[model samples]
Target chain A: MTSLMTPKYATVKSAFWGGVREAASVPMLIMGASFLGFGSMIKDINWSISLAIFTTLSTWALPGQIAMAEMAASGAPLLAIVLAVGFINARLLPMSATLLPHVRHPRFPGWAYYGVAMLIAATSWVGTLRRLPDLRQDQKMPFLLGYGLLLYCGSPLFTMAGYWLSGSVPLPVTLALVFINPLYFMLLFLQDLKDPGRILAVLFGAVLGPITFLYSPDWTLVITGLVAGTLAWYLDGVLKARRGTDES
Target chain B: MNPELYNPVWVITLAAAVSYASRGLGVALSGKLNPEGSVVEWITCVTYALMAGMVVRMLALPIGALVHTPDWVRFIAVLVGLLVFFIIRKNVGAGVLAGSLFLMFLMW
Candidate 1:
């Protein structure tokens, strides 16, 4: 429910800079550490830093990138690797769709949505979902562009660093670096515990996800998402209806 | 023939295309649908569930180096981070840093 045309920032330039400044903080550090870990991962598999950088730029989604690299290293077929990565990255679809409502502005080029969608990784998506509501409609795209571009460019550098410093980084440090991604996500979701439905979704997924993984590792994500999400939605609707009746 | 399928360039190119197609399709689909509608909310719920599942999967049943650490340590570390995060008034960076360090310290 954003207005299609409304001026928020003085110019797209200001909005872009605003995003840049914001990205330079926590989002950048979290992403940098994760990519550093990824870089070292690819290096461990004897892949070149350039290839690591290539995947980082192209895939942008760390999960998909990791799946592709790991699967490729294990001699998985091309189609299998592609499908697995695609499946993992499918979360981006809903994220991008949700964002389009807010980020849409008359001044923003329609075609650029796809390009911006390319940059819609977990970190950016979370940042946008949390922060976009506070922004004016016009500022959304430029701000995202500014924020996304910085992380996008800086990631390859972290990857390269991870690649070069692969062996030197201690095991504990590397593991902790890896842990940062999930820890950040968990804490981020925990902080957003206000909504009952969303809270249920998180709880259901946390419990159901592990159970599904035991049976079907490849499809656990989709299965858990569909089952948990639909259940949460249904229960939330029932709860809302009950509350309304009680009020009456 | 098998090696060709695993070629880094081809693998990355095709994988990237496949991955990006979902995101592009989402944006395109949004133009036809109402953002304020229930469908969008359901999609959002589904997205959240999916993400939470992914994160939990990574934490509870991890791969590679993280597997070396006991599950209790990882879970406890998450609890510590959550506590820090809220106590610090939702400072995400500090929370994450605290959690990571706690994990590191425990492993030490």
Candidate 2:
């Protein structure tokens, strides 16, 4: 017998509203602008407007959606297109794993957990990570759900808006709109530099990512991540061990 | 190639399915794995590496409309954003706005 009056559930309402408030601000603006650019890009590439909105509604990953739209427009093979987009979105695997342990609760059913997991992306993942440390366990899930719901629903509307306004919108504005997400993520990465392992990983990955892209565009992400990440992890371990030995 | 293969409906559907499948698989694994272990630490590092790789690629070799903008302009914008981010005590929103608006101003 679950009671709504339990202290566990006490923070849920406030956490949800807090999430809504947070999403309604910077994250919402950023996502809307990014999706607006995505919609305009779809229009420019001669993809159907419905398809743009559909991709927003379904995948919600901007990079993967763009890859699919662009590749399909070039008449790339369907299997290849699927594989490329899948690889681009493969980052979500670790991202989901990193965030799930913080938010998963026995109070929520499995389906609800999976549903929220589907909505996790760059914006929500980073946002939740930054905020979760301050929130209670119960608050975390509702906050993420609230934030994800707003972002997921708001994106399609902005996508359609961008598609309709594509012609009238200046090229510079559209470019800036598209630039918002990457810039936001990069800035967030800068904030993440406090962690030594992550700092090394970012530094190594930054150098390797473009170099590998020149060699093999399709596998650049996975290759760079695995190699750079492993290197950083090993280096961090060595440093930690040496520091421990010195302390002893 | 089947004409239907390139259909917008099929393309969007399949792409969504593939993207969701990766994320779903992660969720399924999350329950079984111990988050505090070295494996999770490695996964977290990989996630950071992946994000860093993608962000760097976007800044260095952007596609579509961003391709037209000069590379230095983008570089300066990011530099200025980082500068402001630290100056403002790591306020992400202000830094992002500073950088984005700076790029728009340069292009304008």
Query: What DockQ does each candidate score versus the true complex, computed on alpha carbons?
Result: 0.53, 0.52
Q: Give candidate 2 regions above 4 Å deviation.
A: A1-19, A44-46, A63-109, A125-144, B1-15
Question: What's the TM-score of every candidate structure?
Answer: 0.77, 0.77
Docking verdict class for candidate 1 = medium
lDDT of 1 at A86: 68
lDDT of 1 by residue, A120-168 (tens): 8888888767667777777888889888899999999999988777567
Model 1 lDDT tens row, B32-62: 7565566666765675676688788878888
The interface root-mean-square deviation of each model, in the order shown, is 4.0, 3.9
Give the deviation of candidate 2 from the true structure as CA RMSD.
Answer: 5.2
Q: Over 4 Å off in model 1, which ranges? A: A1-15, A40-48, A63-91, A94-109, A121-143, B1-15
What is the model-wide C-alpha lDDT for candidate 2?
A: 0.78
What fraction of the true interface does each of the listed models get right, in terms of native contacts kept? 0.69, 0.67
What TM-score does candidate 2 reach? Answer: 0.77
